[model samples]
Target: MSFRAGFEETWRAVLTSRTLVSTMLLAVVLYAFYYPAPYAHETAQRVPVLVVDQEDSGLTREVLRDLAATRGVRIVDTVADMPSATARMRAGEADGIILLSRGVTRSLLTGAPGGGVGVWVKAAYLLRASAIGEGVSAALAGAAEHRLGSAARAFGLRTPVRVIQEPLFNTSAGYKDYVFPAVASVILQQTLLFGVATFFAGRREQGAPPMRRAAFFGAWAAMTLLGVFAGFFYFGFIFWLQDVPRGGNVPALLLTVPLFAAAVAALGLFLGGLFDRSERAMAVLVPTSVPLFFLTGSAWPLDQMPAWLAALAHLVPSTLAVHIFVPLNQMGARLSDVAGMTMLLAGEVLLYGALAGWLLTRRSDTNPR
Candidate 1:
């Protein structure tokens, strides 16, 4: 049979198998439907706080009022000392502890630049600790500035120069924006990895020939591209057609979107060749997908992860693609800066496609039954 005939045969075989058809359609929906991100509440919420009012004065009461009122923070009560606070944290009642030094009030009233204060957080809840410290410091800074008053002017404490910190890529920091596009590739990669297994299994069981592999691959790519565009357009339009302030660059996204689909399809091809049984491939893929998503820096910053794991994590295409698409959408970076990202994505498709193709070429020798 010619390559064209073989491809038609494989495709027909694939379509005739309800499992493949259903899984393919399901893959499209999973890729297209709502992209979920790490919940905000997961990062910080009802953070238990223990305030040590060393001053124990009216001024400290005002400070307590301010900290308690802050969102996502709950001032449980004051501990007798740092030791007590530490014990509570160990007991799971508190997330952080703040120690107000004896001179906290005096330092503000005296118009001093520095105040004596100590803040400690449970080792496990360091993030919540840092946030509590920042909130308390901000409140104190405002109070100290007010007390400095006219003296603050003489000392140039209230300098006109304001250092404004702006987050570029993750402005709204919506779970949808920060996580969706990156994770989309992860889901894509794994599904295709397992999906091609299903595709090839049915073909092999029916004694299909390799002559149509190209046609099957071509059709598969064409269909997959349609799904890719569908996902991008659906989500991109959700922001643009709805006039949301999502801050995505439409043109850049157009260029970057195709790489992910291509790479994912190539992954599917690689997986199809390696597995004799669809069920076995599906089993391996399930365990692999979780770590793959975790490696994309969704839960923790990649920099903070262990050095060895971080080095290995970069090998995944989803890692590179996620890092690229997010910045393109959020930063609207010019072509020159993003050229490297583009290269990484394109490279993945080329390398992985070649690998999968090579594997598939050897399929007949492997004895499918």
Candidate 2:
């Protein structure tokens, strides 16, 4: 069998449509702000910080109170020592740490030097660490001034508590490494979904039948098999060759990419069949993305979103696929953890495929819109 001329023509027709080009332009404009960009909001809120009260002094307690009552800082939990704090931060538990040593208050009161407090943080997060340090230092400075006379507190202020931030996984504070891979997942879902949706919808409108539709779909699967792997392998090879982290298990992720794409393909076919008119379908499809990405934990953390909305997030295939691929691509999560996400894609494929087929039986040329 050779490449179908009709298939090429169908693709050319869809791709060349002036309306589709206009939609693409519109998409780019919308995504300018929708996609990750510069952070203008400097006032940080809910900044996670851990505390180690080794001193167990009144001064330490007062500092904790101020930290809790402060606007920018958020006290997540208390730890025992540097080792404990290091472990928690390593597991993505806390962003910064504050360790108060013994005699810190005594030094401030008597003007006698003592072992100082240590603030440990990931050096990669320099800006955030600095913000945390400033907040903590100001709070502690105020407390010290109240606890001791101005002269005695002045000595302690000159020799302030140390802040140590160790950048563990990513040492360079690269925003690209953190954000691009996740955005890539969004790209994968949108582009391929559009391709898949257009694939079947265009053919069905042209009067393709059981065998022809089957053949075209089979060819599409083959095409997606190549494209999905190409996208995954291309990124993986770049990471290996260019020193970007091959954050996920390369082979495992590569294996899953096609399945994820296939599920998305099925979803598009489902939508395509649901709306026979190409223009109408594209119109409905294009607008749906903004709300979908908003709900998919791309802009907001899943934990921060409302309970119902978070559950609604799981309804879309992109939600699970994004959860599995983005984190794996960025942070190198194991496949065992994302098995549920894969299953979520499978379930949606079944559901939407059934709905698309059912809707077709009821569709008619004169059917009311």
Each prediction's TM-score against the native?
0.77, 0.55
Candidate 1 lDDT over 163-186, as tens digits, reads 355656555534455556566667
Quick one: RMSD of model 2?
12.4
Worst 10 residues of 2 by lDDT: 360-369
After superposition, candidate 2 runs with Cα above 4 Å error:
1-161, 168-170, 204-213, 216-220, 226-230, 237-245, 353-369
Candidate 2 accuracy as lDDT:
0.65
Local accuracy of candidate 2 as per-residue lDDT tens digits, 78-141:
9888788889999998888888888888776766887577888778876678768867887787
Candidate lDDT (C-alpha), each: 0.65, 0.65
Q: Please report how far candidate 2 places residue 302 from its true position, in Å.
A: 2.0
Best by TM-score: 1
lDDT over C-alpha atoms for residue 125 of model 1: 60
